[model samples]
Target: MSTIARTPTDDATRADRTWTLDPDRALPADPAVRPIAREIYAETKALPLVSMHGHVPVEWFAEDRPFPNPADLIVVPDHYLVRMLVSQGVPNELLGVPAAPGSGVVAETDPRAIWRRFCAGWKHFRGTATRFWLETELVEIFGVTLRPAEDTADAIFDQVARAIADDAFRPRALLDRFDIEVLATTDPAWSTLEHHAALAADGYGDRVVPTFRPDPVVLLDSATWGQDVERLGEAAGEDVSSYRGYLAALRTQRLRFKAAGARATDHGHLATDTTPLTDAEAAGIYGAALAGTLGPGDADAFAGHMLFQMAAMSAEDGLVMQLHPGVLRDHDRGRHAVFGPDTGFDIPVVTEYTRALRPMLEAFGHHAGFRVVLFTVDEDAFSRELAPLAGVYPSVRLGAPWWFLDAPDAMRRFREAVTETAGFSNMSGFVDDTRAFCSIPARHDLARRVDAGYLARLVAEHRLDLDEALDTAVDLAYRLPLAAYATR
Candidate 1:
C-alpha cells in the first residue's frame, strides 16, 4: 500500500483523502499466509489477459473511437453499479437505464448529474468487488488519486475525460495497453460478423475472435423468433421453415462462425436440460413452433433437443461448448418495463444440474474430441453437481464463479467446493465477462489475488508444495482459459 496523499483540491471532503489501493488488497487477511500469497501473486501480476469468454462490444474495437464521457464509460451501463444504486432506492432513470418497448420513459440525460449520483453512492459499494474494479480503474488507469465522492465527482470525471480524449486511451490502444492476448466476443449465430470481419481484414483476427451465441435463433418462445429464423435462413442460405433445414442452417452458421475465427459456442438458457428427441418428434415440434401451434412444454423440449444436437455438432467440429444456464433475467417486471433487459434486475434461483443434463452427458461425455464448460448462477451445484460431473466426464470442465457470485468470498468458496472433487485441471480459468472495458484488468487482478491466496493456504497446509502451488496459480490465472478455448 502506498502512503501517497490525495492531491490538494478545493473540495474539502476529499482534501485529506488517504485512500489507496493496496497491491495485496484481496490477499489472505491472515498474517501467517500473506507472505506466501504475495509471492504467488507477484509471479503472475503482469501476465497478459485471456478473455476467452466476455461480453465487450466488438464495435468498440472496429470503430476505434474515443470513449464519450466518464459517466457512460463507468457509471450508467454497468449492471453491477446500477443494481446496487437501485437497491438503495435510486430510480433507474437517474442512472440512464433505457425503457422497454411498451413503457414510455426517458432517463437522466445529464452526464455530470449521473456521475454525481454514482459518486454519492460510492459508500454503498463498500466491501463489494464493483468498488475494487471502479477504484482500480480510477487510480491505476486514469491516474486519478482523488477518491470518488460528491465533492470530488466532477474533478474525477474531468480527470477521466482528459484521459478519454487522449489518443493513447482509445479502445484498441487500451486493448494493447492492457496487454490482452486473445479477447473473444459473444456474437449472435445469425450475425454477419461484419465488425469481426473488419477487424480481421485490419489484421487483428488472431487477437480478437468471436464466440457463437445461438440462443436468439433457437429460443422459440420470444416474439422475434420468426424474424430470428428468417435471419438464420438468410445467413445459411437454407430453408429454416422446417426442422431439418433449421438444423442444417445452424450447422452452416457454426461453420461460418468457425471460419471467422470462432473457437467456441456459447449458450445462455434457462435450464441445463439437454435431453434429445427422436427425429420425428423433433421435426413435429419444430413445425408446430414455426406454425405457432406448439404445446406449452414443446418449445423447451425442442430447445433441450437442440442442445443435444449442438453437443453432437461440437463433437464433430471440435469447438468447445459453454453453457451458462439458470438465470432469471429481468426479475422485477415493473423495473424491467422501464429498464428493458440487462439493467441489473437478473436474479438466480435454485438450480439442479445432475438430473437436468443427464441426457446430453450420457451421449457425449465420453466423446474424445468434444469439450464442454459449464457455468452456473446456482452455487449449490458447485460442490454437489458441477465438480462431481466435471471430475468424471472428460468432456466437462467447471467454469469460474460467475455473476453475483464473482466476489472474493464466493471465489474462495468456489475453489474449496470444486478443487477437492474435480481438482484444478478440470477447472476453466478466470473470465472477466463485462461490457465495461476498463474493468477487465481489475477483475482479472482480483481473480489472481483470490486464487493466489487459495493456493497459498494449500501450500501452508502441506497439501501442495510451493512449486506446485505456483504452477497452479499461473494455470488458474492464465493457461487454463487459453487451452479451454484454443482453436481446433
Candidate 2:
C-alpha cells in the first residue's frame, strides 16, 4: 500500500522518485546569489498570505463541507488545467467540463477517469506555473509521495482522497492551515452576499470579504445585459427606465457592497479608456440601450464612461478601484458558446495607458480620496506607461503582474521593469488573483521566491544593501498589500 512521504521514496516503475519538490526552486542560479536568495526566501516563506483579489466562490466557505473528491476539487473547476488539456486535443467532456444546455457535449462523469486522464497528460504542465502549484499542493498539503503519472495515478488519487476526508481539510480549516490572513472573493454587482453575511455571523467577517465586480452590468455588449440590468435594478430597488435611475441603482448597489465589508471594486474592461462622456451623451446611449436601439461603439463609449463614473464613486465611498484591461475575452466563440466564459480562451492585446487614461488621471490622479491599482497582461506598458503613471500619480499604485504574467519569470521581469520608476511603495504588492482556492499559498510562495532572487541579485551587484533588500522583501510579501487595499 503506497501511503505518503515528505522525502523521496523508492518506487518500482520510477524507483528514483517519491516526491516532486526542490528547496531551491525559483531561486537564483548564480552560485553567490543563490545563498543570498535562499536566506531572503527563508525569512519571508512563513508570512501569512494576503489574497486581496481572487475569484474563489464565497459559497465554499459558507457551506464548510468536505470537498467531494480530488478531480472536482483539483481539476474540473481549474480553467488553467482544463484549458491546457483542451488545447492538447483532449475533449472537454473527458475533463468533466459541462457544456451549456443543448450543446450536446456530454461531460465525463466519473471522477476517477478524469483524474486518470489528467495524470496521463501530466507532461503538458511542464515548465508551467500550474505544474509548480499542483506539485506543491500534492506534496506539502496532501503529503502525497508518488509523482503524477499514468502508472501512479491511482495511488496518488487514493492518497489525496483519504487526506481530504479529514475534518482539517474543510474549506474553513484549510484557510487556517494555509495561514491566509485575508481572502477577498470577487462578486457580481447584483450579488445578495448572503454567503458573506453567513460568514460574518460565524465571526469570520473581517477574515473573508467580497469585492465589487460590476462587469456584467457595466459592459453593455453582453447578450444578458438586459436581463442583468433588470436584476441589478431588483437588487438595488431602483427604477431602470431612465439613465439617472440606472446610475442610482449602481450607486446603491456599491453602497451595499461597502456595508458588506468590501474594500475594493474590480473592473475588467477590454480597454482602459476612461474619458468621460457628457451627461447628454451618456443619457442618449443609456436610453438607446434600454430601448434596444444601441448603435455600434455606443456600448464601448458607455463602458469607458462608466469607468470614469466608478472612479468618482470610489472617491466618494473610499473603495480602492482595481482596473485590468486589454484582454480579448472569450476568443474562441464556438467553445465559449458551449462552455461559457473563464474556460481560458481569453487572449491579451496591445494596451496603452498614457493617452488612454489621461482624462481620468487628470481628474482624480491627485485626489486625496481616489485610489486605483493598475494591472496589465501587456508587459510593454510596465516601464513605458504604468510605472511612470504610478510613479507620478498619488492616487495610483501599480498592481502586481496579472493573469498570464503571474509566472516566476514574468514576476521577476515585473520587479526589474517597474521598480526603477515606481519603486517599491508605489506598488500594490503580491495579489494571488486565482480562482483555485488551494493555489493561493503556492502562488504567493512563488512570488516571494522570485522577489528574493531579484533582491539577492541587487545586493550581489551592490545596488541595494542586504538589510534594505530584506526589508523590501517583507514589504512585497506582506506590508504593501495590507496598506494598498486597507479599507478607508
lDDT of 1 by residue, 1-488 (tens): 23346455534564457556777788998898999999999988999999988888999899999999998888876889989998998889888776665677778888989999999998899889898889888889998887888887888889899999998999899988999998999998888899999999998898899999998877888667889889989988999878889999999989988998999999988877898899999999888888889898998998898889999999988889999998987788777656765763888888889998898899889998889999988888999999999999988988998888889999999999999999999988999888888999999999999999999999999999999999998999899998877755
The Cα error of candidate 1 at residue 55, in Å, is 0.7
Give the lDDT of residue 273 in candidate 1: 82
**For model 1, where is the 10-residue window of minimal lDDT?**
1-10
| lDDT values, one for every candidate | 0.88, 0.90
Candidate number of the best lDDT: 2
Candidate 2's error at 53, in angstroms? 0.4
Residue 352 lDDT (model 2): 88
Question: Given candidate 1, what's the lDDT at residue 314?
Answer: 96
